[model samples]
Target: MSDSSGMPMTFTTGQMTSLYSLAWTPSTTGGYAGTCIFLIVLAALSRLLLAYRHLIEQKWHDRAMNRRYIMVSGQNETDRERRIIGGGGEKAEEAVLTSKGLDERVKVVRSARSNVQGIPWRLSTDLPRAGLFTLNAGLAYLLMLAVMTLNVGYFLSVLAGLFVGELAVGRYAGIDDNHH
Candidate 1:
């Protein structure tokens, strides 16, 4: 039955069929878009945290440096005045800074990050270097696969890579199997 004419009916379509979707609809796009957005936001938050940490560290360093400047300048001015006033015994009042035996072992460790420039090459130079290359390459390939795959596959691959890499490292460095 028709509305009023009662014989036959023709339907009219609306213009806003696609526009019915929310302009900022995220939920409709399924998992990929939502997951990617979440990962992006996570990465951004982590980066911002790192930057804030760096800023705080730099602020502390700056404060320490400023204090050092005051102490150093004051000591210099004192020595200068002492020399101008005392004739010969100024050496008795010589300023000595407390360095506290900074052994630079920390520098050696931190330099690992900076001095990683020729790292692959350095690994090549080690004895039984093929093992190092294999270990490094295996770690890298697994890391790449991890970034691309589903969770279970990534976890399995990482485990396998770790075993292989550890075996290679131990063999190359002459460590017994029990060492690890």
Candidate 2:
């Protein structure tokens, strides 16, 4: 068979064809194999980006929780001090950390469900997340286009890439199973 350019189409071996664009045309079997490998790596890279975005989100959450803990813990300590000094009958052991105090801290930390810096959501904190989302989407669409070539080799390569990528990074990607 022949394409618009009159070059003999290599449908069987999936060679001698253009993929995605003119620049991606592979003229030989070896070139086509190389292209397949490139597609696999590119697909895997998209998963890596997803894992990176997850890491950033986790870090932000931890930071915000730590900040809230500090704020709440300090306030609790001050209140305890006042109660002890004002009453003067309570033992020094009352100043020790208790389960109730910890419960209060946890509650305070969980209540603030806003951005990393506490309440004010800024574009600066969101830019990296947005950029990664765009990049990951672009890579996914690029791989889809490659598969649209309907070449058996390219299709399998994309599938293998996704499997390998998930094995490597999907666990840390923080995708909830219930969402699926």
Candidate 3:
């Protein structure tokens, strides 16, 4: 079996193989091993990035909860009464437990937001999260491309990398599969 270029269209354990691009072909045993190692490291790094993203999310959640507490405590009796009346009493209490209180709390959080070196607080937190997401996405796509090569060695390398990555960082990333 062959393609238009006459290259065999089948999986092989041959040393000569192209990965991601023709220029990346590893034509020697050492080169192939290095490529496998690179893929392993790339997979591991993606997991590490995922763990960092989880940590950032946890941190932001904590901060948001703290801000909610501050808003609740900072409100005067009149403000609380007005909120209960304006939002409806039982609904207001539920709102305090949930999302509806966000609007009223914004003013207080804004002060803390502004105190952060003149940078908009949302931007400061959002940019890193967005950047990490973009990077993780790119890495994931690259790994997918590596798997698409159909070479048994490369495929096994990817699986091994994922296994090693999960063993190293899955717990910290909160990727609990067995409820443990």
Candidate 4:
């Protein structure tokens, strides 16, 4: 096909079916080889940028607090009540009280749980934050799929991108820390 400038466009399907080669067109001249290399490098850099953005999003979510409340009932009520009252005084007592008073005390818990056991309990409150991570996860998966195409150029590009991205943001994102 001819483009607006009347230069012919050539399309070729590579031998590898699994490899969904990127739709990059090299300039129709002796410099085509250089143009192809440039495009590959650009794609690699773009992948790195995407990874960096994902890391940034994760860091932001970690720092931002999305306030929510969880109701504690059943056998744990009395224990929770005592803990709240012990630390919070009259305000905590008043906060836990329902219209029926102490007989129906419902402990209001903060959304952010410190450990794994609290995940199920905090699902409702944590959904919004989870949604943010979901987007980052989706991008990561897409990058993985691209890598799976098994095109040597693209595969190397993705690997290099990941290595560079990790080096750039690993410490800032706390990925290098043992505690996390």
Candidate 5:
């Protein structure tokens, strides 16, 4: 069978246990050089967009905390406080008596936990903004599928994309910064 573009359509159900396949077809050209380069660039951008979505979500979560939004389930203030201070090495007491009021700190921590847990649900339910989360997830799944193609070059391309994406968002996401 051929697609509307007159390109022969192909599908396979065989087990994919490797990372090498010639399944991807570029829209522009069928030549290996053109298609491979296109797929590589597309994969890289998709991964970058995924990373950018994560950065956006992180910022949103922080904003939600600032708004004092809490979504914890079956956890009370004491539980939250314990979770926060229990990991205190030696300055647990000092950690408790910071500039911010105890209640305020507890609220922030609770909100953060809530944001973490509710992210999936919120992404599906919250309109417009949910698009980012959905896109991130879709890109992740697509990247996985691309890996299943088992093509060494495709696998390398996906890996390169992920690495580049991380580098692009690392500073903005504060991934390497100590958050204590």
Candidate 6:
């Protein structure tokens, strides 16, 4: 079916109300709940994409640094690496040396790495705090949808809840810049 917004309607406020007693739809509601969910998913994806961009750039920079180091300082570090890998061509000794050298390199790699995933990034970094702030602002939005869906008489409370819930979620996600 088509909605007032000129979009193909799915399960709508009316359809939903028909299914559940004491529910109704109005022109003001405007299918906000479903759209809000989509928006949340979009926000999550945006965060992931941004994290990936940073990680990819970091990897590229690291590769360049490593190559430059190998070309410019290879000989200088050779004496130290002798006991680690391929040092003096003693196969076993060289293997040990190589492993040890890699261990040191691993530290550098770790230092350059960052938490790109959501759970960690949200919990430990500023990203979630920022998200939280946005979510807070969204609270009124959700309440309006839910209220409009429920056809509850208290419009103001419904609006407040909607905004509060949205803002709370954003704050909890720690995506708000003002939060920190």
Best prediction by TM-score: 3
lDDT of 3 at 60: 71
lDDT per residue for candidate 1 within 148-179, as digits (tens), equals 33333233434454454444332333222222
Q: Rank the candidates by TM-score, best first.
A: 3, 2, 5, 4, 6, 1
The whole-model C-alpha lDDT of candidate 6 against the native structure comes to 0.36
- Weakest lDDT window of 10 consecutive positions for candidate 1: 103-112
Per-residue lDDT over 1-180 for candidate 3, one digit per residue giving the tens place of the 0 to 100 score: 668984657876777779988899998899999999998888888888787788887787555444422245566766653221222344343334445534444222222342335333587788887898899889888988887677778878888887788789888885642211
**Model 2 segments beyond 4 Å from truth?**
1-13, 69-111, 114-119, 177-180
* Count of residue pairs whose backbone atoms collide, per candidate: 0, 0, 0, 0, 6, 35
- Candidate 2 lDDT over 1-180, as tens digits, reads 768965545534447657888888998888999999998998888778778888887886665444422223445555632211122123322332445642333122222556544544548657876887788789888988877676778888888888898899888887652211
Model 4 — which ten-residue stretch has the worst lDDT?
A: 11-20
Question: What are the runs in model 5 whose C-alpha is more than 4 Å off?
Answer: 1-30, 68-125, 173-180
**CA lDDT, candidate 6, residue 1:** 66
lDDT of each: 0.34, 0.66, 0.68, 0.46, 0.50, 0.36
State the displacement of the C-alpha of residue 23, model 4, in Å, after optimal TM-score superposition. 6.4
Ten-residue stretch with the least lDDT total in model 2: 81-90
Comparing 1 and 2 on TM-score, the stronger one: 2
How does model 3 score by TM-score? Answer: 0.65
Tell me the tens digit of each residue's lDDT in model 6 across 63-180. 4333211121234555432211111333332222232453322111112233334112223335554564455446434443444444223333344433554454443332332311
